[model samples]
Target: MDNLTHSLVGALLGQAGLKRKTGLAMPTLIIAANIPDIDAIAVLLGGDEHLALRRGITHGPIAMVLLPLLLWGIMLWYDRWQTKRGARPEKRLPVDAKWLLMLAYIGCLSHPLFDWFNSYGIRLLEPFSSQWFYGDTIFIIDIWLWCALIAGVWLSLRGERRGQPSWRVPAITSMAAIILYIFANGLITGRAEQLTGRAVQSQFGIVPAMVVANPVPVQFWKREMLWRDSNHYGQGVFSAPDQVVLDPKIGQHEMSNTFALAELSKDKNAKAFLFWSRMPVLREELREESKVRILSDQRFGNPLVQDRFRVVVPTEQDAK
Candidate 1:
C-alpha cells in the first residue's frame, strides 16, 4: 500500500523463520514486496501512463512467478563471489541458496495477492488477461492491523523469557483484526449511507440522487450526496451531513455526460491518493476543446499534490 506499511509486513515476514542476522530478510521482503511497482519506471521513463503498462506486465502473475527467481539467482552469484574472496556478505541470508529461492517466491507473490483486497484490484493474470480483480476487503492500511503487528513485535522482543518471543500469537491476532476491520468498515459505510439518506430526506424533503459514505479518522465520516434538482448541490461532513441545499454555482445539469459522471462518481484515482485527493471535493472540467480534466479543490489541500493519472474517455469525438 505504502512504504512504511510494506516495511512493517516485511519485518513480520522476516522474523518468521530466519536465523542469526536475519534482519536482512525484513528489508529483503520489503523490497521484494515493492518490486511489482517497478512499473513506475515505465511511468517516469516512458511518460505514457498506459493502463496496460501500469497494471499489466509488472502486476501480472508472470512477474510474481519470474522476478523472485531472478533476484535469488543474482543474490546467489553475489554470495558465491563474496565467499570465494573470504569476505562475508552483510546481512547474510541463512537458508540454503536453493531453499532461499522458494522463500523469495513466497515473499514476492504475497504482495499482489494482498493488494487485490482493495477496490482498485490488480491484473494478477497479466499477459493471460488484463482484467482487474478486486476482493472488496481491507482499507489497504488499517491502523488496527498495524497496531496488532507492532504490539506483537514489541511484546515478543521484550521477552518475558529468553531472546525468543511468541510472534505467532500476534500474527494470528493481527490477521483476525484486519479481517474484522474490513468487514466492520463495509457495514459502517452502508449504515452511514442510510443515515445520510434519511437525513437528506428529512431536511431537504427530497431524496438525493446519490449518496456515498466512507470512514474517516476519529470514528467520524465524510460524505457526498448528489441532488437531482438542476443547479442544486449537496455536500457535508457528518453528523450534520443530511442538510444540503441547491448550490446554483454547481448545478445538476452542469454535471458532465454519462462517462464524465462515472469517472467522477467512481473516482478510484482520487481514492488511490487518499492523503492528497479528496474525491468529493474534486471538480471535473470538460474543456471546450472536448477533453476532460479533473481538478482538485484547494480547500482540501489537494492542489499541492503532484501525481495525476490520465484515463481514456472510452470513445473519442474525433481522431487525434
Candidate 2:
C-alpha cells in the first residue's frame, strides 16, 4: 500500500476513538504506520537492492516487535521535549506509556497487513525465511480505498469539531466497511484464480505451478490473471462467470530452459532479482553475436511499463 493510504488508515484509527487513549496519538499512529517503510532507504543503493529490501525484515516478526518499542521511545522523548519548551502540561492529554506502546504496535502492524493485500508480496517471516506472500486482492494504489478512508476520517473529524454526540461513528463504520471490502475482493481473486487455472489447464493442457489474480484499477469484479508453468508464462483476464480474455499480443512467453536460467542466475543482479521476484520469467536472446539474458517479474510487467525488475547480462563475446 502507498504511504497516503497508510497515513489515512492511521488517522482513521485515531478518529475512530484511539485518539482519546493518549496524547499525540494521531502523530504516533501516522508515523508508526509508515515506519516499516524505513527500509525504502535501500533505493539509494540502486539496482535491485530496493526490490530485495522493500518489504523484508522491516515488515517481519523481529522488526514488528522492536519497531514499536523504538517508536514508543521517540514519542516519549517528543513529549519531554515539548514539556521542556514551557508548554502547559494540562493543555494536552496525558500520554500513557502502555497506551503509547499499544498504538505503536497497532500502527506498525497495519503496514504489513495492508501491504499483503496487494500482489507485490511481503516477507512476513524474513530473517527467518525469505518466502514471499501475496494476497492478490487489491491494487497497490486503490482509489476506492483512498476514498473510503478519507471520507470516513473527514466526516469523523467534522463531527468532532462540531461537538456531535457520535463523532466516531463514521470512522468506525468506514473501518468495518474497508475490512469487508478487502474480504470480498479476496474471495473474488480466489474464484478468478481457480477459474483461470482450470481454463488454462483445459485450453493449453498445462498445469500451472502458480497462478495469481491481480486486481486491476477501478474494476472490482475483473482481474488480470497471470500464471507460470515449467516451460511457459501466461496472462489473461477474468470477468465473473467464466469470461477469460487472453490477448495474443501479450498472451504468453516460452520460459527459458533450466540450464540457461541457472547460468543467468549466477550474475549478482540476477541473483538478487530472482530472490525478490515472485513470478519471474527469463528470456535469452542472441544479440550482437552473444548471449543476452533478460529477467523480469510478471507481476509488474505490461506493455506500457516495460521497465520492470530487469537485469540484462551480456556474454563475454558481446563485451568484447
Candidate 3:
C-alpha cells in the first residue's frame, strides 16, 4: 500500500475511540505512526538500495516497541515546554507509553504487512533475514478501498452543532471497505484457481502440483489472470507463486496444444516435462564468463528493490 493509504488506515482506526477526549489526535497519530518510515527518504538522497535495511531495522521488533515510548515522551516534554513559555496548556496526553507503543506498532507495522499482501514483498524479519514475504492478495491500491476511505474522511470531518450526533464515520466506512475487500479477494482467488486448474488438467490429465493465481487489472469489464506453478512454504497456493507462461503474442490460453501444451506438442521428446505433475522446469542461468544474463525473476539471486540486476553474457574462455 502507498504511504497515503497507511496513514489513512491508521487515522481511521485510531479515530474509533478518539472522537473528543484529547483523542489520539488521529491526524497526529498518522504522523507519529509514519515517522518511523523516514528511512525511505535515504533512498532519494543517495542512490543506495536500502529497502532491506529500512524495512528490516525500522520495522523490526525493537522499533515496533520503542516507537510509542518515544512518542509518549515527546508528548509529555512538549506540554512542559508550552507551560513554561506562559502559553495556555491544551489537553493532557491521554494515551500512555504502553498504549502509544501498541498503536505505533499497529500503525508502523501496517506498512510491511499490507505491502506483503500485494504482489510486492516485505522484509518482516530483518537483520537475520533478508527474505521477502509476499502475499498474492488484492493490488496495493484498490479502487473501492480508496473511495470508501476518502468518503469516510470527508464524512468524519463535518462540523456538528451542540447536542448533535457525532458520527465516527471514517472508522465505520473503512471497516466496511476492509470487510468487502476480504470477501471480494476470496471470490477473485477462487476464479483464478479454477482457471489454472482447467489449464493444468488439459495438459497433464491430472490436477497440477499447485497453482499460483495473480489477478491482472486490465480494466473494469475485462480481467487478466496469471498462473504460476505453486511454489509455496505452505500447503495451499499463494505462497511463492511463479510466473504464468502467457504467450506474449496472443492473450488466449487453452487446455490443448495451442498454448497450454504448445511446447510439448512441438517437442515430442520433452512431453513428460510439460506436465506440472512431473518435475518442475529448472531454469538455466545464461552465463558469460563470470557474468550471467537473465531477468530478475529468472536469476537465482536476491537484489533489494532499488538495485538493478545486471545481465551479462559469459565470455568464450570463461565457459572452459
TM-scores for every candidate against the unseen true structure: 0.60, 0.94, 0.63
- lDDT for each residue of candidate 3 in 1-320, tens digit (9 for 90 to 100): 67777777766666554434343446446765576676686566332234223455566556666665676677656556766897633554554545654565566666666666655455566655655564656666666566666666666655222333655755676678786775566566666566556755564444544444443332212123433334311112222133223322211122222432443333322332232111122222544326322212211123443124322222223434
* Deviating ranges (above 4 Å) for candidate 2: 88-90, 248-256, 286-290
lDDT values of the candidates? 0.52, 0.87, 0.48
TM-score of 3: 0.63
Q: Which residues of candidate 3, in runs, are more than 4 Å off? A: 19-24, 41-48, 87-99, 159-163, 201-211, 215-224, 227-294, 298-320
Name the lDDT value of residue 297 in candidate 3. 26
Clashes found in each candidate (C-alpha, N, C closer than 3 A): 1, 0, 6
Residue 265 displacement in candidate 1 (angstroms): 20
lDDT of 3: 0.48
Specify the poorest-scoring 10-residue window by lDDT in model 3. 232-241
